[model samples]
Target: MSDGPQRFAGHQSSHVDSDAAIRLTDTDAVTARYSAVQKGYIRDPFTRPLLPRGAQFQPSRPPLINVGTYVRSEGIDSLVTQWLELSQQEGKKCQIVSLGAGSDSRFWRIATGPHRNTVSAYIELDFSENTTKKAMAINKSRELKGTLGDPSNVKIVGGGTTLYSPVYHLIPADLRIPPHESLSQAFQLIDSAEGPILSPNLPTLILFECVLAYMSPAASDGVIKWFVDYFATSPEGTVLGGIVYEMFGLNDSFGKVMLNNLKARNVDLPGVEPYPTVASLPNRFLQLGFERAYAMTLRDIRRSCIGEVELERRANVNF
Candidate 1:
């Protein structure tokens, strides 16, 4: 069965409030604001390059026993760490592609820092609306820095213009469908000037954080298949960096308790049949033609920030 874009539209608004939910038409603007809010809360100074002034502000969490922080910090940090390590690998320049990259600053932050020269390309793929917003943000940053005599190293790639420095190529393609075909068109536009995909000597790392769970199982499977197909065919070997923070089925008393809580909140997630243990993620990766390079649970971070939580899994995939 074929699913159009709206297959997931209803699910999107249910995940967050209207103010925080990413609109298909203005996803880029929403992403920028979301990133600004995150940076302000995490106190990450690097976010200054992407977020506009006065964009930083704190949101009040639900009083008493809010477990959302664990959902954000550990899951997000693990994904960032994986991407950073891939970027800093020795001898070869790596290409980092962020899938559904909502307001992520790793490219800008890492590119401008010690690993700037080590990265061959930093591509951020998202909805066209969001990608355009990011480009505008990057251009605005360049303008602001020019006034201060300190220019940024990021460059927007699509729309037929290419600059010399580390190009922040924005391939605005929808991932919910066949990304390879759409992405191929975008890359052709980019490859016309930027040369070719970065060499295979340095691995390409793709990051997917907090995105799959929101997708239907079929769409999620399509996404995984797209990545596996890309890496299998691409000249470069690709490593997938993924953070899965949503609830899966419970196998034990602990798992049941977690599910009950989510059920109480009227959230029903698909994908886990009879709900496999979170540790079963490695098996899922292997099923999708990816070998698990590393896996860790952010239970500690969850405990510290959001009280006791049953499961959060982070893994790195190599093909």
Candidate 2:
């Protein structure tokens, strides 16, 4: 919990278990976790693409702007692409799981006609309270359908709904704990009547975007290991999909600048680790029995866009 730079002075008062403590569950809490200066940098129109629109609170600059957004966006795109590809190959129901999916509108963004049919289910995992808030927001937005007109096709069902329709399942589980146990229990309870149940061969696409950076390196390693181990429970040829991670430079100029600013404010984040290089990530995957897979950097994506903004991409592997 005490991994990175303390962005706000008042944040220290809330213990990790405190209700006021900032966690990934609430969008505001997640946004406030970033340094004020970083928040500013993300708001800049030119750099806005790096950060998701939902996370941006106001227009301001932070010491670490470009690196943050670039990594986040690239990770999101990577996972989405992997999910779509896996669905095509398996020719079975596709299950898309978003870990710490904070205000990401990917389900709506990519949910087109044929594409929607490919995905049998879309699950967004976050804190129970946060997920409830998101569902409420979606429902309220519907009342103004005349104006917004159901922004996303996400249907808010009281319980689990049909697989063909877009359903948002808010599984309130904590990432810091063992996710598999909780997930197994959830599947048992939710997938009782849903024939075949949740299996590895069901084309599961798990995504962790902008979530790993907040955790310590050991924690991140553990999380990845858990996923690999969980997938082993599935039948052979059961692909675990891709694990997309977006990380910022640890020793980059921007990082140093942010550290100095935090130091001046009398707040220290001792456990913060810099982004891991691409070459190193493949080995991590190999340790978990995952093959060294495809990867791309934010720099390459920006280059393809032919924009003036220069972004840095680290070697990322898809496993």
Q: What lDDT tens digits, residue by residue, belong to model 1 across residues 105-204? A: 6665565556666667766666655555656665666542242223454444555222223445666665656556655555555443645543334466
TM-score, per-candidate, Cα-based: 0.62, 0.64
Per-candidate RMSD, Å:
9.0, 8.8
Worst 10 residues of 1 by lDDT: 310-319
Candidate 2: residue pairs that collide: 37-61, 37-62, 38-62, 40-60, 40-61, 41-60, 41-61, 41-62, 50-69, 278-315
Candidate 1: C-alpha lDDT: 0.51
* Number of the predicted model whose TM-score against the real structure is largest: 2
For candidate 2, the 10 contiguous residues with the lowest summed lDDT are 310-319
